[model samples]
Target chain A: MGTEDDVTPVARPGRPYDRSRDAQILAVTLDALAEREYEHVTIDAVAQRAGRAKTTLYRRWPTKVDLVLAAVEAAGRPPEADELPDEGTLRADLLAVVDSPWLGGPERRLAIFTGLTSAARSSDRLADAVRTTVTEPYVAVYRALLQRAVDRGQVAAELAPRVPLLAQVIPAMSGHRLGATGEPAGREFFVSVVDQVVLPALAHPPGPATPA
Target chain B: MGTEDDVTPVARPGRPYDRSRDAQILAVTLDALAEREYEHVTIDAVAQRAGRAKTTLYRRWPTKVDLVLAAVEAAGRPPEADELPDEGTLRADLLAVVDSPWLGGPERRLAIFTGLTSAARSSDRLADAVRTTVTEPYVAVYRALLQRAVDRGQVAAELAPRVPLLAQVIPAMSGHRLGATGEPAGREFFVSVVDQVVLPALAHPPGPATPA
Candidate 1:
């Protein structure tokens, strides 16, 4: 009677199954999230809204947090390392990343951020996924960029080895959206920070890095 | 009988009922926070622990959120505009603030941060105060420091002018603690960020400011 059975890939023969059905379910999850807070949104309600059987929803995601996280993931992939800009300079690369339209806007990012934080507090598995999938990957790309600068002798060899890459970028980018009334980061802001602040601290004159 | 009153300033006698006793009450509120989570902590519990009357606590704060906020305020002020380090350079100054010992260690900051975010979800006043008093002060100091740089012709012209600076330093400083793994900010790490990442980004020559 419904598209549920058709969309949901059935499990092998007698085994449990469904792939396309899961996608529809995840889409419905997003719709439900928009309509209600994460705490109030439930699996039964999601199934009801999707017009799918309750068992189908449970089979895909074990819990509401898992479902919510899956929906977030479905919204977009993390900015891939290769997708990062490298215009032969660090400043330009940072600006590109900061201003990328594909990246979720401040409001959406804030929602994901708060959701991640809450899920982390409530469940360890979600925390692990966030660290491995989101935090670490982005940090690695920046660290790689810094490493390239260090290799080119554009920055002090010691600088890239020690800096907390994620710490520097995330704060400036997320500050305002996270309820800070500060000026939002943009191309000039990114460039200024890179040129005025980052480069000076890192450009060792072919000597030992000084004590901070 | 209680030292809470002694440690905290007393209310004035006549002109108006001094709100100073609220400070005393909040001190005890912090003591309670150290022992319990936000859900478990209560205003009556705070009054009982402080040896102050419940009516006195209610008269000043009126709600649990207000009481907790007063405790946060009484804990100490955020870094002041003048207090931002001025070691003849912006990089050193920023490193000082990020690595300041008086700001409380990472764990304590995380606790306060988590508590505040959790409270803010439900209470508008708490949310506003967290943004205004705690978050804005730090952002303002950063903006002021950047403004000083701009004045020195060390940074770009037309930088976004605002009371709360949006350049990302605040988030970069706090992100690690608030995020999943919750790492602490250290002096050397901060210096590297200020030097390699932050200084270059903010400097005028658009290159490294100091030799690494």
Candidate 2:
């Protein structure tokens, strides 16, 4: 259900955008996010921490979700384009994601994502930003991996329509589970995720997208 | 990392336990949880909203996780077991979950789960509570579904270790995606989830719990 006159505020061009202030706000927001789960964080606290008045914060962020989203996007280090692996098989390429430092090491990213999702239950725009900024990197890697797989004919060309679901589910499940439980997404979880979930879906021939 | 040598303050038995007070606090916490994402909510705020002293809130809850867990447990409507579908095959029984109103309805439950998980990134007890209380109902249904499948010889024995992963991943993906994107976990999504991820894992021959 959509709400409010607008979920995101348009920049009024009232003042020049200050990159330094942007960075500071994000840094403070990230600290606050790390300190407490998203539900406990307040824009006022973030503003207080950043040494910016609430108006200064709102001028750019427009909404609390926008502010938090910007912070999380900044905190997350996107995989470098050069870092994309071209290991021969589709499996090896996808394994790069499994083995990637970006996805595996930090507890913070998962925590941040989970926190946004909890809020996203009510805010549609927050969810969009998450998908675009946070969910996009892995999705890009998955898309590349799948494109390579399809190019090699390792998977049927027909699997294309369903790639949206397939791409993010791994990161979504793995990250969410770890974020929620403090359990490391150990090698075992990754391997089973690949073998039991990802691979199986690919192997099964597709019918109509809708299930009976 | 363990924090203050003593975070959870023990009760002094100075007064009798007030069940009504306990209910009021939980109701307030649940409302707070429903109103905002977990990271943004604070104990002080919850206390203020509940019109209770912080000491009184802490006397019962001890930790933030403890308070939130109690609220979520209270808010989630326990599945009316009679509602479980007994369709002949395991798949049908499991499908009942996708069709169930509890998972599909208002965003509160998913919000509660996501918030708990975000905190759970740090708190082991909170994680246990989430899996135990929030995830347990579905896990139980999945266990029943799998037992029926194993009994019918529709699937092999070794799939047991992986059921935990299989059962929750759908809700995790679907709910997280919706929460983040404001998109519905459409029937098509549910159909694809079962077809692509779940059925294949079951059909694949059992191997060691961890992938080689």
Candidate 3:
């Protein structure tokens, strides 16, 4: 995932790369990924689809893995803490989080994720990129929202310590739904998970914590 | 997934397929699947690996899809309703469900599942096979266990209608964990999900049912 500074010609000795075209190239990369598996995605195809020279993509991202990682990173930038919705209630915030277009909605996001499935298993870098760029941020946002609810006395203070574990429920379920069914989990499904599962789980009085 | 009757020679007009050997071939199919992506698995390779003639395999399962489907079905036999654990409590039943060596335990199951990721998207039959063979049975077991708890006066009766929705939480979360991290969700993770998410959600008092 390169920023403008990484592509600026000052870092390289040769030709000046057109920084403005990076977004288009990345978008095409994602499209290529969405349409095919990771092993099948080639930098050559990406360049041709983006209507750019091979050298241009190579100068920035040296390998297919690099390009895919960058495209995924760009397509799913992690939300800043302040950028998350503060809807005054955990349920509202959780609902808003899923509704936001973080990775071009659930359909496109699932396509992109499925595209990287095989590669991620073998490539630690790709796994880390997906975890850090896509999964971790969502989990963090949920955790923060849960903590916020506890602080507001909407959720029980006794459950505050369990916030970290509870935070992963919605994201895990959403990801699982997408992976297992090969269908995007829509707003309705998200609402059900929030209302039926997450909200209810939060409502439970803390039982004696079992140490694993 | 096939029963013993499927391989018996009574139905076929040609050479008698070794009904006993069908299990060995299916096991090899699963091994192949666990080792490689669906596209990469070949009947020739499976025959070689299993020390059987290619024609023999073709006689039994005509195509790669057919063989893979049969293998998956064989590997993951859906539990009969009565076969599920009735451990007196819903939590114990769920823990038992996860702990049961269903699909050869979590690690092999995850490997087998990840191997099918790409093909499942395009092949409706494969998708259905996975859903019916793997996902549906687990969901059903959880649902039954939850319903039993309601019947036994352990879980709240108000939550009875929510059984179907609540049942999916553990399976969906487990599936998500496997897909995202490419790791087997072991007993410890399963216990956490049950205690921290499933049980808590079950404990929550129902609100006015929101219509989708």
Query: Who wins the TM-score comparison?
Result: 3
Strongest candidate by DockQ = 3
Per-prediction TM-score, please? 0.64, 0.56, 0.72
lDDT (Cα, tens digit) per residue for candidate 1, span B129-154? 77776666676777777777678665
lDDT of 3 by residue, A108-204 (tens): 6556666665456546688778777777777888898888888878888987766887788777776667656666566777777777777778883
Runs of candidate 2 with Cα error greater than 4 angstroms are: A1-36, A39-69, A73-77, A80-84, A98-127, A156-162, A175-188, A204-212, B1-86, B96-135, B180-183, B186-188, B204-212
Model 2 chain B: ten consecutive residues of lowest lDDT? B1-10
Off by over 4 Å in 1: A1-15, A28-63, A72-129, A152-158, A166-168, A181-212, B1-20, B31-49, B52-63, B73-79, B82-124, B152-167, B183-192, B204-212
lDDT of 1: 0.57
Report DockQ per prediction, comma-separated.
0.24, 0.20, 0.38
Tens-place lDDT per residue, model 2, B1-212, is 11112233335587656554566677677667656656777888999988999998888888788888777555553363435677655555555665565633445544444555455444556666666665566656666666667666677776666566777677667656654554546555666666656665676322222121
TM-score of chain A of 2: 0.62
Greater-TM-score candidate between 1 and 2? 1
RMSD of 2: 11.4
